[model samples]
Target: MTREAPRKRILLLTDIPPCSNLTAGIVTAQMCRFLPKDELAIFCVMNPHLRPMLCDDLAGIEMKTVRKPTELQRRVLRGIRVGRAGAAAIEAMKRIALPRRLIRQAIAYGRAVGATDLWAILQGQTMVRIAAPVARGLGVPLRVHVWDPLRWWLDAHGVDPVNRRLDLALFDRTLQQAASCAAASIPMARHYEETYGVPSTAVIASIDPALAQAPPPKLISDDSVVIGMVGQFYASEEWAQLVTALKIAKWRVGERKVVLMTFGHERPPNDVPDEHLRFMGWMDQPEVIRTLAEHCDIAYCPYPFAERMAEVSRLSFPSKVPTYLAAGRPILFHGPSYSAPYAYLNERGAAYLCRDLYPSAVYNGLAHLIEDSTLYEATALAARGAFLADFTLPRMERAVRRFLGYEGGKAGQAHGLEVV
Candidate 1:
């Protein structure tokens, strides 16, 4: 009797535990889920510690948690302490020797599991240097996943310009060595092609429709309109502007409160009084969806319109937009025209987009959404339709598999492949 062919194995190196509801983690887990299970085996490696609230979906997949500095790394440090290595040598030992040691570990793990491919999924520059050596040593294809413009992001967040420049140079060199690179969006792919001259395949971060059911539609008879936002509250200037607009909206509506409901890492600013804002810090996916459906009439997407932010807007789509759409609500987006969300929503007439980037523009947009019921309903329908048609898990799965060089029947191709 003929023996069946063994499935190809792929080792995915990522930031944290897969499907931990973190943006990149969710995409990574979904990619693994969608790959042809009969043809490929997925193994994942995450550093430090895994999330306690890890997703229970990935059964039978091998997961390894790497504590920084393996046994070899510790031995090298011990040798340095014992005068066998000098102070200058310590930096090289930690930087060079440590990754090589980890590479050996990765090779052993890959061999044990019969992995034929090494994928270095990078959320940022943190793992690029280490992953490069690991992929090189394995003599297998290295697929690099680029999520954002890391150099621009660091520069925007106030990293030293010189250091950012240096890091950008290093990341470029690392990317050049990859067998293939996948971008998070088409704009991101264009950005990489222009800046780094590497042709990138676009594989957007998408939501799984089957993972959780959308909450029942909440009745909207209340006097107040609650505006909901999920994810980090990064741009305080924009937040202040949004709060100011909502206050104006409240006054115009009379006896109706304009509430800002937020979830995730940061809390609403101390200045945005308790009456105007409700902060629920760090909610899981289900809770976030339930809260949005029950309390929020409109979803808020805010982007700061600075030069750095303009660059950011052009390179990547906001992760929260898909989540907001899946909740089946109209979006009140405040961003530049170049941003992927703004461009998409504006083109599709799916959001009340405020492109002018001022308090007056945002106030007018919010007022329009609150006062016009017909417009609100239409926008909400469009948003949800967009999500179902193009941004669902099944569509994302096909896009990812195609980008990764999978060949098979085109069962999901009608939804369209978005590789740029």
Candidate 2:
């Protein structure tokens, strides 16, 4: 009897693209980078708006839209009949319940496309609950990647205590069903194990080396200092504190200014001192990277010091760190010392850690770095070296392959590195 051919089909279930530079998009892009483009038949189930973004160059991968009621449609239709509160309740129900329909559609698509493996990258708990039986029926392994439980929890609850409880229960149930699980960091992996009794592998979000090659530095005065922060600008109490710190820093430092490059919908307060604060509006990925490379002198990773933020710090690795590292710049991380990146930076001597969110500490740290050119360059070089060694695309690909039990004997040969 002839042996059956190895299955080459994969089903990737994720949110649609183009609106935000989320961790999900980053991981999906990384998967595209390493997965054998020619051999594997890929099918993506994503939001309708994201269809145009996943073009032909993605190794002939096919995309199918996961149809659901749009938020506006739901509000208009339900609010017209029912009260706004009732409509909102209905929308919440839909959010929790829609994944089942989405998964059924995914299963049908997978079977149609002859998929042998089911991979889920978003809606973790819901995806696991819905995809488990489908994978079992199809006799395929189910792989689930968890990036941030806090984000997922907040998304599910949104300040509703009852919904928060329901979300946690669902999250636990879904986590229990995953055949293989991956987390974004070591701390996250530990949290998964501790909370859900499931083993998970650490896989940080990766950067394409080609993209990591630095762009031409932006033109600025040699003596002018610019501290930069990038990514979303969701309003939070910590953000208010960040503004206060920046104000204090501006007062202390004569020539330096703080620049926030964001894709956030909300604008910074108009009254923020013009001399100290510069808000560069929404930038595309290339532009963001170029801005970071050319203009930034110090990278700020500031988040609120709250329970939810602490959970985020533990469970989610920051993608911006690699981007900053790639820019060959020093990072001023303002958060808990126990965070994974904080530990990593301390180990490498690449970041300055602050114990408190006080303005004085923030001011002092920024002042010292601005004055000490030797310290700044040394930290920058250390950060860049760390990225090249452990956080690049190739490193991530090998980790994913190992977690999938596909590590080859010659896998480390190209890098002249040994498998741990």
lDDT of 1 by residue, 107-202 (tens): 777676666677776654446546777777677777778777676555543434444465577788877776677887777776676766665777
Q: Give the per-residue lDDT digits (tens) of candidate 2, residues 224-267.
A: 66777766543255456666776656544656445544433345
Error of 2 at 419 (Å): 12
Backbone clashes counted, model 2: 1
Query: Best candidate per lDDT, number?
Result: 1
Candidate 2 global TM-score: 0.81
Give the poorly placed runs of model 1, Cα more than 4 Å off: 1-6, 36-52, 68-98, 156-163, 193-199, 210-219, 247-255, 410-420
lDDT of 2 at 211: 57
Query: Which residue pairs in candidate 2 collide?
Result: 218-294
Error of 1 at 106 (Å): 2.8
